[model samples]
Target: MERLAKGRHHLANRTSLLRMISAWESGARDASDPYRLLLCEAYGKSPDELGLGGGTEHVRSDIGLAYLGSLESATSALGELARFDEMKHSAVILGKYMPDALNAACLDWLFGESLADLRLSGSKVTSQDVAEVRTMTENLDRLDRFLGGEQCRLMALRYLRERVVPALKASKTQAVGRDLFSATAILCELVGWMAYDTSRHSRSGTSPRP
Candidate 1:
């Protein structure tokens, strides 16, 4: 907390700051406004990176709207889209719908160069990982059918951001990688449909096509 108050003259008392920190950490209170900014600075991370949702610096309003050139870029774009949707709660008013951009994205997808092979050193991605994502997509589809996409879209986005996107960077055989990409594409399609069901048509158009 001292680190957060370094140059500030009107600092809260140490005891009060400790109490605030305790409350924030315990989920008894949100770290709002100036405190949130202070936490971000002290940690050298954006609020979103710290799991504090309201920071505009890290929230790209146009995320996932264009066709990226490589697997790495596509993976990063997917993470950004999922994070934005999760944080904004499918608020369409904050986004613009560009049919032209969507058209270009689709054209690029159909005729663009194939993504280069990824052979990074990380956890090994196997056929089982692909199956798990497919299974989760199926279960989420069932939930969407019953509960509506608005009710369940956040869950799907969270899984895509937290689980599947990271797995895309992991080490995998060529066959496993192909299968994994196919499974992830199906999941992305489901997420897009869920966004559409919630009336986030722009979001549906922007989901990663890989």
Candidate 2:
């Protein structure tokens, strides 16, 4: 929820700072340690060169995988909850930036026929989808359409992990930057919690938190 200028740490350069700022737009998983570590590496610094220390690429990926696991946990938690108020309150808090995405997510999570259905319901594809289309980025206008909006950084992440890097890997280019896939794992979890929790709370007749 914090702005780039308002986030906890400040980098010495605009590029690194923009990477962090881009994390928010991309989604939490894309911002994972591996991704940030790679980003740091791109900047000619190890993760330790920055304050991240051992927040290496692998470590960040582990974190993201763990959060991806939590998505199911949240779903179970929501299904077992007796009140919508608690859930709704949680969603409202999380919707600070991606309100529409979070809102639709919450609604689908609670009211959907089942958890499996809920999982498949939304278009919360995120910027990772942009990764799939980046090869065509010679057209800047198309790039703008693909990576534009509040979730640009989120989508930008996919461009690295899912689309570009994979293609590069096919040609054996080898990825040298962040493990943005893991970051998306966390992003999905965060939005999942926000959506299910908020919708649950709202359905339970609980007033949203002040």
Best by TM-score: 1
Residue 122, candidate 2: alpha-carbon lDDT: 25
Name the best candidate (by lDDT).
1
Clashes of each: 0, 26
TM-score against truth, every candidate: 0.70, 0.19
Tens digits of per-residue lDDT for model 1 on 33-54? Answer: 4677777887898766876654
Runs in model 2 deviating more than 4 A are: 1-147, 172-210
Full-model lDDT, candidate 1: 0.77
Candidate 2 lDDT trough over 10 residues, lowest sum:
59-68
Computed on alpha carbons, the lDDT of every model, listed in order, comes to 0.77, 0.34
TM-score of 1: 0.70
Off by over 4 Å in 1: 1-61, 89-93, 114-119
Candidate 2: lDDT over CA atoms? 0.34
After the best TM-score superposition of candidate 2, give how far the Cα of residue 96 lies from its true spot, in angstroms.
Answer: 26
